[model samples]
Target: MPSQTHPIDPVRYGTEPAAPARPIAAAPSAVLSAVDAHAEAAIALLSDLVAINSINPLFPGIDRAAVIGGETRCTDLLGERLAALGAEIHRVAPDPERTNVVAVLKGAGGGRSLILNGHLDTVAPFTPERWISGDPWKPTLKDGRLYGLGSTDMKGGLVSVVLALQAIRAAGVRLKGDVQVHAVVGEETMSHELGTSAVLEAGFTADAAIVVEPSSQPFPLSVAPVSAGNFNLEITVRGRATHAGNRGAAIRPGGEGASAGVNAVEKAILVVQALQTLEEEWGQTKSHPAFPTGFFSLVPGVFHGDAGVPSVGYMADKATVGYLVWYPPGDTADAVKAEIERHVGHAAALDPWLRENPPMFDWKSNWPVADTAEDHPLVRTLVDARAAVLGPIPRGRRETWSLNAVTDASFLEAKGIPTTVFGPGNLRFAHAVDEHIEIQDLVNGAKVLALAILGWCGVAD
Candidate 1:
């Protein structure tokens, strides 16, 4: 927590002077050699971490103790590694079972500070047998990727940071700016309030941050400066219930058709169809520069309709539909909510039952946008670092790039700490049957991060 401290002797950081270093080319990669030297160590640690089942217990529909609740153990393992590197470690556990680790290797003072963040939790492997890697818990190396449950979704990220820090410490480079390595929990479920946000709420932040969230796919490994906002909406439709035999009576011309009763299932179908038309309209109307055409969407992920019981003999009395919506940056979640309610409200007015008893909305999770300007120093330095290390930047990976999905970067941005999403793992395998991250991606990412640190934090002469 203190902002400034005496400059650590450069010799203490490496075997030689911290020499005026700028890793965007110009400076020798005496420090980066550590990454190559310990490449096997990085892979070993990644394999070890992936072996642990750190599935988030809070994940919906999963509460098995045998497979979940590994956050505290994972956090402890990282703490030990950072401690071995001489960094001061602090552990924050919002839930007694799930702990977050913040390892701060304070700078000697002068340059900006930075935080490298990643989550420790993983989504439960629904069926371990379906995993082509043979076992989701035991990492299998095929070609160049290390396949495991958390490898790509991102235990690989943690490995990259450790490698960078280890390389820096081994090179004996005393940074002018502070570096905070944040290994958190609950990211798979957007529980930032208890994870990333909690770390900041505890006053551990920096001038800028890079969430090592997986960003590969439809493009090579890249840096993303922004992410879209999203929300989980559940719409409940109500209707009158009566005996199934009343269906004919309700529909017959000479029967009590007008006042017999209403079928909630039929009414719910109306709502679904109405929203589909709006979703198609959104495809043509809404657009963001970084996102592909029609990327913003309203997905009906879950639908339920039934009476009080599962019996088909009774007419359904109620129905509920759950939707996941993604909106572009510069837009508020409230605006998106209001738009949906308004669209459905207008459509509801068409039906007698819906007009009388409108659908009730219960908005669940809200993940705000993580928006950072492309011209910011953090962005510029990372771009320069990428160019310096990889050369000939990959296509579509320009500074203004965006992430395919939202991440906890939003929490840091919300706290006024500029943040970006950049990492080694490919998004194609994230949360897939055989999740994995390229071993080369990890090494490349570590090199870039090492370079970024040298430039952004500045080298103490």
Candidate 2:
């Protein structure tokens, strides 16, 4: 008789068809049942997390102390739940009050660890009166959507990680490699003092990481590069205080005893006109290769006038202005900065008032780029997992787009970790009235994450 060869089980290197060399020791039924049993608790934890108002300090009246207070509550709650799951937890804080919580779930076998990252802080809730249906702090479930502040932006993603781990624990499904869940603060505002940067410095490393940022429907993962910057300028014109009645005489070169001098506001208009011309020319030339050809944008956001009070007495002293610049992934921050300075310098030389009070420019603080090759094992695994769970992934993609207004992904990416921003929900709803996450999308995200984690750790079945 010929000897027969048996097929190998990918998940468990075992000769027996149903058995593995290293099984969880618990039946599959038992593991799944545990997950099902704890599903309600997992949802409850998310509900509580959303209930806490952890708005960023960039919002009006939010001070450092208030932000810290919110961070403490969020860390405390996550710590309690993670500790119960048998994970070793660490709290790192530059400030005594604000903290970043890290929970490590050790694996039975050694392999590369995966990082599950989420931000605890969110943008401020818009005016309560503006809410269309539910309060920002109080979460409401209606028409299969969970509505609350941070519901889609990220609280939902954080909840999913917690619940997935809980189910794994309850079912006694031993992981092949470790998993680290990091809940961080300071995503909304650009703050170096306390945020993801702090966590990285505290010595947190992972082979790959996922940032649970909000996404549009059909569950598209963001793998595009995003760049942001800031600029400022000032203009001043020379004019003499004079009576309103004498304004016409001031305009005349040599009128009968002209008391009024040149009108400062009039000169300011000329400077603004010159600035607009420069803006149009610069806007057309600048482009980034990684992003769409016209992805570059500039906006004049702030303007200040120095006339003492609103009353029109003498000519205005000066006019100050500030703006923002956004470009595509491959664009260089230093180049953009140089271009801005050059334009401002040119404008100042031409205009006399502007020459006297030249424009001042300041670039936005450095925000690093988070880009990993599409062929990277971690990136490919996530792309495949998302496709399996949510259908065909969206097209026209690069590596890194706007993760949030500005997230620590940039900070962490600087430290040499491949990171991608992925999650469920419409980005439009984030920070808007009646923010929410569709239940189905949230479920799909959790399933996709679990499968991706399995693939990354080489778990097979």
Candidate 3:
């Protein structure tokens, strides 16, 4: 298909002349009225989205499908709304059961495009019993917070994007450059092969993109520079089964009055200790502006020990130790894997018991580092627009440290498009027992988004 072009008038899309250098007063009554009206609509949309659960699991069962299916319904409903507003809608489905929706609102100028991206999936509710006051799937508005699964993690941010677009439409604002609203899936589990990755591969291009991830209070816009890669190591210790009744006493002591009868668990513990030492050493030096001062992190998030039945009659056959490692952005995936192998190699060499019982290691590659510069036009426009909308810009580093968790931003960045993550809500609330988002934060985020789009796309003042 060929590119489509739309005619635009620059004079109509450009901002009005700046007022004399003086403090601008609060938003005019009319502007505030418009914002309030749109905010009400945004809250309604967020509540609706929160009502539908879109939890992504490794193997989704019928119940899970019902949840994911809601994403499809949301996309379809959003598509119709965008189409009614004169935007072109494109639906991309990797599987017949899973779909990604893109709604493009063309500008008259036909200049560069901007993308507002959001994911439709949330981590499954771990313990519904722990949800003190309300059900995890049903949204509850208490005080100023809207609670439910996916409320803060990002359904609120997604709804904000939709509301921003709707507000612009309602205000009769015409844009100079196109805007694309992309709602994708499979972000919770790093299954890039299925969601935004598919959308980019299908030829979606934008000059810049913003992922609506929850940001901390004061909503300091974050531009992530480095992301950590995830890897895992598995160590196995093997021991010979011997008759505990007499064979153990027959063997002569080797060193320190120690016999051949060895405890595999003890050996595994030594290996774990050595790995911990390595992590401590590495942690002392690795530091990045976005990340906490540290070299990297090696945590034994999971471990497993299995022995054949009849423990008294047989020696432990095998022990498996699992360790997770987070590598900094500059570290190559291959290098991280090699480092794990080296640790295992050192463990094998230190203990003869380990030499006889080898350790195995593997890495689970995460999305490659995704970054955007502070000086980029997209960044500057958003910053300027934010300052314009919310007075007195906050001071902090421009970059954000990757959560070590994967997001759809990876896919868009991989396509050579500049991307950053920003939105409302506190990320700490994400996946929590009582996940919720502040109504005010959601409205403010929508305002920032609307202003940023207007500033970047050159919508007429």
Candidate 4:
């Protein structure tokens, strides 16, 4: 009889079934439990972050101490905590005193990578005296809420991300892919060159990302898959200068320069009226399911009359009006700008004096929209994880929505990395006096982040 090959030793046969795959060590319940266990610690970290006045110095009337050292204080605290967790830290100062903390938890490889991003800066206290809750920097944990500056805008969200990683590590689960937590500065000032944009430029890339902006409610469109784009425009209206006393004579029935001068302020008012009408038209015509009605708007934010023009006596020869335009994805800044220019041209054509001196437009800045499909895997993972953590969705509440304002996530999405927004706290409270976040919201957000991490990164066998 021919010697029988050992059954255990597989022969070189294509028909043989492949060996069974090894199971990942991760358990959803275990991870969730770990996150719950560490909830207090997460809140503590947030509390510490809140205690530091990391107000963006760009704002006027910021505390001198915060301007000099607040950002560094917050960054140092974050660095210490991340280091204790064994994450590799990459410190970046994109601008002077603007510290960014990026910590990486390397995985065993072969799985998708992810980035959890949050801003380190908060708007300066608009009116510290109006803080009914307490001091903006002296954070307080009271009545199920953590109250202070930056608590809701994003510091709390950042803490939750760190706690989620800690929970994963505590559970002894090894991920197959990398996870990066980036805490950047200058977000409140919307300086892409120094905030998340700088982080990406420093070579922190990932397969997908989550921008932890406050979105605690489970309303329809709660998870922001898209955000409006923005741009600033300055229109210069030029007119012949004349003394106020002589203005009437210049236009006295074809006075032919008898009217001492044309008033640019008057022309600017016409432009404003036209723009208001255009805004209404845009409201009726352009509607996104995720955004509120008339999400695309042109806001006149500032107006400047000619220098040295007295309030009563001078007929202003030059005036400047600034507008901020919010448009949806696929809407080009140039196109919006062109439309505005056309409106100005139309208004000027109707005015004999303005026909010769058409309004001149200067673009200040432009940013594109960050958009992701609701059905994208990243979004699905977040929705599922949120549901798992927060329970069933409320009736008639949309699970996804679009942000009316832009975030640093826009930069990540622009770079081709699919991204979505989710976090804890009431968005209405962000940047408001005595901003605060609910303690339970923090815990729930951490749990969801942990679950999402496990689902996205996968576990190493």
lDDT of 2: 0.63
Give the worst 10-residue stretch by lDDT in candidate 1: 1-10
Candidate 2: residue 73 Cα off by (Å) = 0.7
Score candidate 2 by TM-score against the native: 0.79
lDDT of 3 by residue, 237-340 (tens): 66554445534453445432224455555567777887887787777755555666663777876655435664666445556677667777667777767776
lDDT of each: 0.82, 0.63, 0.67, 0.78
TM-score of each: 0.91, 0.79, 0.83, 0.88
Higher-scoring candidate on lDDT, 2 or 3: 3
lDDT of 2 by residue, 255-325 (tens): 64323454556655655666577667756776544344544555566655545666666555445555555
TM accuracy, model 4: 0.88
The best candidate in terms of lDDT: 1
Question: How far off is model 3, as Cα RMSD?
Answer: 8.2
In model 1, what is the error at residue 185, expressed in angstroms?
1.1
Clashing pairs in 2: 223-400, 224-400, 224-401, 225-400
Q: Tens digit of lDDT per residue, candidate 4, span 214-268?
A: 8643241157888888887888888767777776677677665725687788878
Cα distance off (Å), candidate 4, residue 364: 0.8
* lDDT of predicted model 4: 0.78
The top-ranked prediction according to TM-score is 1
Off by over 4 Å in 2: 1-40, 58-60, 63-68, 167-172, 217-293, 310-314, 394-404
